[model samples]
Target chain A: MATIKVLAKCCGVSVATVSNILNNKPGASAKTRKLVLEMAEQLNYTPNIVAKNLKMQKTRSIGVIAEDMTIFSIPDIIDGITDYCQKQEYQILLTNLRLFKKYNDTYYNKDDYYELVRQEIKKLMEKQVEGIIYVAAHERVIRCIPDNLPIPAVMAYGYSKSRKIPSVVVDDVGGAAGIVKYLLDQGHKKVGVITGKTDSLHAQARLIGYQQVLYQNKILYDPGLVAEGDWTRESGYRCAGELLEKGVSAIFAMNDLMAGGVYDRVEELKQTIGEEISVAGYDDRELSGYYHPPLTTVSLPLHDIGYKASEWMIELLNGGELENAGENVCAVDCMLLIRKSVKDIT
Target chain B: MATIKVLAKCCGVSVATVSNILNNKPGASAKTRKLVLEMAEQLNYTPNIVAKNLKMQKTRSIGVIAEDMTIFSIPDIIDGITDYCQKQEYQILLTNLRLFKKYNDTYYNKDDYYELVRQEIKKLMEKQVEGIIYVAAHERVIRCIPDNLPIPAVMAYGYSKSRKIPSVVVDDVGGAAGIVKYLLDQGHKKVGVITGKTDSLHAQARLIGYQQVLYQNKILYDPGLVAEGDWTRESGYRCAGELLEKGVSAIFAMNDLMAGGVYDRVEELKQTIGEEISVAGYDDRELSGYYHPPLTTVSLPLHDIGYKASEWMIELLNGGELENAGENVCAVDCMLLIRKSVKDIT
Candidate 1:
């Protein structure tokens, strides 16, 4: 807790001289600097970082606002960001808004929700964060952006509807298309689909991808072969049961959890996966790799998205020009992890 | 960014008069205070929080070092901490060390591991956190308290080996005993157990609880009926298979993931759970309620632990004496959630 005044008094010099020597500013003689430093060490002087930050106008810290932390994907994304920040010697001020719970509350209207988010941003600003990163709990279009923000901001796992803020998102459509095409190339015909909530943007985009592949293969798109699911294992189970009744040879579930439900139903019917019926899933979650037959699924590059978002924030902080500052949408590719679940019809 | 100096100059008042009036210090007349405040508001002066914190010698912020964020129980604990901090108007500086990965590295010796942890603590200190909370990835005895720590530190979900630091942990033995007693009351005498890694503190404590009940009921302890698992569904599946071969009527898997594996094996062998054989699990994870026949498990009070740990830190900061400061261990009781997984053998 020793201060500059105490060190200066002990070294028989002015406080400014001791401060200059400590800050490595020229003007203090070598002999004087050496004597001041020795006195500081002897006194166990610890500099006040708050004063230093105020003077420099920078804290070397970034604010990360996570919409919710319970979501399985958000943690991995945060891990990626943390890794990058640690290597750069930057600190993170993380605020979990629990927006998922608020969005479900009837008393909190849309305006109230936005107001809550604005309050969170203001709190971070008061902490003097140089930049901010908004992480969405789910992959959806975000419409709320505080007006006239002074600091650099970026979005991850979601984008702003106004297209005025930069974002890093997964190529959901391409991932769906690639997985469906892989199934088609394996000589599978009459493929059934378990779509996510019909209102979901991801669900609609993935459905379009499935239809496009079917059309290119000269196969007629059958609406009866598609059943709607709510991205739950039970929904997947019910939808897969309905699809089985339609006598489809293959089933493409939009997510791995639903695919697990499909597996459960297949086993119930005295049938084996990858043989009696081919199954594929998306979002290659951790459990997918250990699923009974292993799951053939698409891996969402969440880590890369998180890493790239931090990179963009750092770039903006360094006074680098952002390409397409407004309407800037960076899409990362999804990888297909072909495991033991898909049958080799060829 | 208007400074008080600018406001004072614009209002034609001395800086000391403006400062005293703005701070509501005594000796400033009401009329003078009103005039200074009106002028400051008109000038849109925003007080520099950094300077204020420097003068106060406190940041009103706490550092939370999460050993790993991917663990299922961690997010809920963090959510509890965030909820409490938000209510108390305290900011949290979050740092994810990803120590689980580091512990697995062969090159990272004991000293290196502690050094890494010390480095994380130093970073938070640089941020001027008033207190520190260390969140362990799992429940165990920790030995890595940095030497000569200068801040008040607490642990959540783990304890220090020296017992010098306070910790909040679930009553693992009591929770296990309560659930097993419930099973015994249902008239199941021949019970089997699937335990986690023997080296784990939770595993050993839970095992002791299980044996205590058996001894109380005059049922001889049978090591042959116990199978060791690695806390994974696969290990549960394999161990359950071995236990089933011994014709045990009731099985208690130490965790829900392993309980899930037990369910898979039971179905594979064409046996109905909760009827031919009863199954129970611990750590009532998210999917436990959705499992087929639903799982009867022990719910760890993670939220309460988190809330209490923060309460302890805040108390320490308020200069309140920590009860039993060193060797202080606070244990919260776990609740037993009874579902359809346990059968009425009576």
Candidate 2:
């Protein structure tokens, strides 16, 4: 309940001096600053942030609208954003759309989704957020960016079709290629692939990476070696069974969950992972390291992407242009985590 | 940039009329209100929230400081909180502490943790958040609540030891007891227990519930049937193997993840899950229903707890007392989700 006037009176200093010391503004002597701070602490003076924000015409806050909070990967990305914001002395206004529930609802449509997102954006704007960050739960393209938002906007884990707005995304194609090249270098000639939905951009890109590696190595691109999965453990289990029937020496599941399913199937067949057959996965999730024999996987640098996205938004807010940032899209590199899942055939 | 003055001039009305219509104050005429709204929409008038907040002396914003974001359950709790806040017309300022990383660091101690939390609380207070909701990633007792916080603080999924502040927590003991009674009524006498760390309060509470059910059923309590796990799938697998050696007819793992491990071990032993051994787990996590036999588990009502916590905080913010809320702790009941994991063993 103590105000600056009370603290100033208690410290035997003028109110302006106390205010300068509290706000870290110039004109307060070091001795005055020390005395004021000590007295303020003693009196438990709380600064009036609402008045300060009004005077500054900015809240020192940004809004983050996440597509869904339940997705496993989204939290880590948020963690990265929070870390950056904390260090930069900015707060976050978060809105979780719970898009999964909306997507599952029969009555929900694209128009409704857009309307809901626009409402959230308007709400944040009304709160005087300096910038906005849209985070996608999955790796996909966002077709719309709400043309002409007054505040600077950045996209994380997804991109806009027009590429006018800045975005930070994972280099899925490069990551897949790196993993396949590692496998091929280890002499995995008959490597089978368990892919996610064929329609997915990430799945297509990963498949392309697989084929590129095989083409460069002069190995025959066998359509029979690829099996489709819908990114579930059951699908991976079934798909791995089909792949094993073809007598493939090694396998690559597009995700760690599918890789886990493949591990289960291999164990069921009395085969030891990393010994009788080699396996690798993507998205080095928490369970990947604990999987039997652990998992050789590619780590999606989602946290880095989130951090970079926040940095870019802050830059944009400070009147800096993002035009030189190469196509308005920054692709963060993925890390190859070489665990015990993959064996060296040589 | 369109202010109420511009809208008032365009609408041929006074600035007070425009302001009343905008704020939904009762003084504006119905005709003037309609005209002002139409002209405001046509002019794309966006209210200056900073100025409005300064005038009202309240921001209508709440701060949610999550202990850690990466924990699976925390997001759901946040989702619940967001849902309620949205309905109540409140905005949220979120801060994820990433305490898991700090907890794992050898240099981090209790003092550092408290100081970090205190700083976050100060940050939120400085932003003039009307109320504060401190969300813990896990269910545990918070030793300190930082005495004399300016804003009303509520604990979600955790409680302060002093009980001066209101908290919403899951009834873990009641949940465990309910599940055990359900199993016992199905004629299962020898129910093996896979518990978390013995030091955990939840683990101890669940064990007590198990013993209470056994005592009520006139069955002898056997320490040999209980196996210790560290709340991980690996630990569950190892502990289930030990429990199976004791020839128990049914098993109850402390969590769905551990139950999943038990299912895998059961399948590895060439035994049917629901028929050969009935299984039940707690915390009906996403993957529990997708497990081979579809785990029958107790659902922790985290969302309800979050909703209740927010409602209580809002009540306190409205100058309503939570005096009737016994010991400032509201324990929400957990529901038992009946699934295929538990067989009716008559």
Candidate 3:
């Protein structure tokens, strides 16, 4: 349990000297090395292998960096990494920066935590990790990634919201387009959107997709049709209330959580959902399937994406080509799970 | 990208010689080490640090062994571990056993997978993992864990379900007792339960609590009042149907997933939910609050349990006494998020 500092103090040597002896570096004298070793053994010292390995050749591990670690998307991508790594007998180091939780005054700016991330990556680099997987829960035009990363890197669940690097992402535009097209097909002239925080890249992309659909169909776009939520059911409930107050005949919730909120609020209003008002949601989360009058939602094959990213990461780790015929923008087609929520407005 | 063996071949030396030189072991002569080093440098050989570390002392990383990795409970627990370990700067090695997916055959008994588990653990051991977190998604008892583990170990989600080792679990009995008492106070006499997986410890404990409430109230415990599910919505739907067929007025689903299922099924039958048949669920998952008649379910603070478990593990890691202050059974209290899922059935 004793650290190198403690061992160094007990052996009457500098901390760096103790570190050198433990790492088997050339500078330490034989006597000092022997004395440090004996003292370290007596103290039950565990050298920071990760720190020591930085100078040595290999660590047989990779780092996975994610914006939101708790969300479903990160794990789905991790599943891919795990499967692929297991095949080639590799390991992963997972790091999460809770980007949503307010760490500094700047909202969604992970700049304060970038140093911590870089520190871990430095240890990984020290350990000489072979590769890195950068996973972001929501698409963002992040500005702080260091250019000279020490190893091969892959991005998952995000597009370069600003088009900086190649990323693997679901076809949010196509998926959103499909939903709007469906509503139009149902003869809905007044359809509205319940969306997330406005500044987000993921939300913006979805908005773009929705707008493109309306543009393609020659439908007049209305700013009154859009309402922003915090991506929670409560947000959905409040936003849907505001949208309903605007008198839209149909609503498309950007995610399942918001859709669920819409379901509860609509019921409270004594409005017979799907008959009085059509509704749809995204994410197709497991609960969406069983939502009362089950949610008509978009199903992002998160599991498949997770598995694929990890697989590709393994390929990259093995010195395989980073750019593949199927590599960039592997848009996982989102499926529309129809249930009782949407109704024919015609 | 190239391995040590490939480098050795390129350098005209035995793989052992290359490995010895790379590891900085004194066995390799200076001439051989220098030649191997020059060739490795030329070929850009980076030893796998994880692999190299495994060959040395124990990996400071710990393995989190779980039945299924994708579900809500396990992920929360793992996240808790990750959160704590990241603060303490420890690495985790995750192993998803997929135990729910049976690999049974004529040649392999249930214990066969245990051997594979052992082999995997051995790999972790060879990799030098300092400890293990055995996580069970279900309540089925397992007796296959080897007694002579080389490192510290703990169980989660359920009490060992097999051994009497240290464990961290939610207070299922107390939580269930509270829900039943609440339902009883609401004047429900003929209460029913959509029970969890038959093999689960939490399920068993919950059922006992439900029965205890009936006994305390002098209401006869009826066998027809209970139906079983595999802790999924599909199973909840089927179980609710079975229970409804037997005519229970109110139902308490073991978890939120099942409760959501019950809601969907009852709606499918053209019956008004939270009215014709009242229902409740556990876990208080995020979607529960968004249920059409927002689910009145028990909220198990799983993350709290996970955080506490990591705290305990860290304590153990630091040579702190593994003394239980009669707190080995860390029962996280569950809250009933009241919405409109259940109705008072007299």
Q: Identify the leading candidate in terms of TM-score.
A: 2
Assess each model's interface with DockQ, reporting 2 decimals per model.
0.53, 0.64, 0.13
Clash pairs, candidate 2, are none
Q: On lDDT, who's better, 1 or 2? A: 2
Off by more than 4 A, model 1? A3-46, A101-110, A215-220, A286-290, A324-326, B4-46, B102-110, B216-218, B287-290, B324-326
lDDT of 1 by residue, B1-346 (tens): 5777888888788889988887778877788788889988776566766677888888988999888776777877887787777778888888887776667633234678777777778778767888888888778776676635677888899986655468888898899899999999998988999999998889999999999988888889999989999999999999999999998999999999899899999988888999898999999887777677889999999878888888888988898987866558888899999999999989
Report the Cα lDDT for residue B54, model 2: 69
Among the numbered candidates, top lDDT falls to 2
Question: Considering only N, C-alpha and C atoms within 3 Å, which residue pairs clash in candidate 1?
Answer: none
List model 3 lDDT by residue over B167-240, tens digit each: 77877887888888888877788788988877767888899889888888899999888887888889998998
Ten residues in sequence with the least summed lDDT for candidate 2 chain B: B102-111
Q: Looking at model 2 chain A, which ten-residue stretch has the lowest summed lDDT?
A: A101-110
* TM-score result, candidate 2: 0.92
Candidate 2 lDDT over A1-346, as tens digits, reads 6777888889898888888888789998888888888888887788877788878787899999998777777888998899898889988999988888767732134777888888888888888899999998877778656857778889999887655578889988889989999999888889999999998878998999899989999999999999999888888899999999999888999998899889889978999999988899999876677677889999999889889999999999889878566699887899999999888987
Ten contiguous residues with the weakest lDDT in model 1 chain B: B101-110
Comparing 1 and 3 by lDDT, which wins? 1
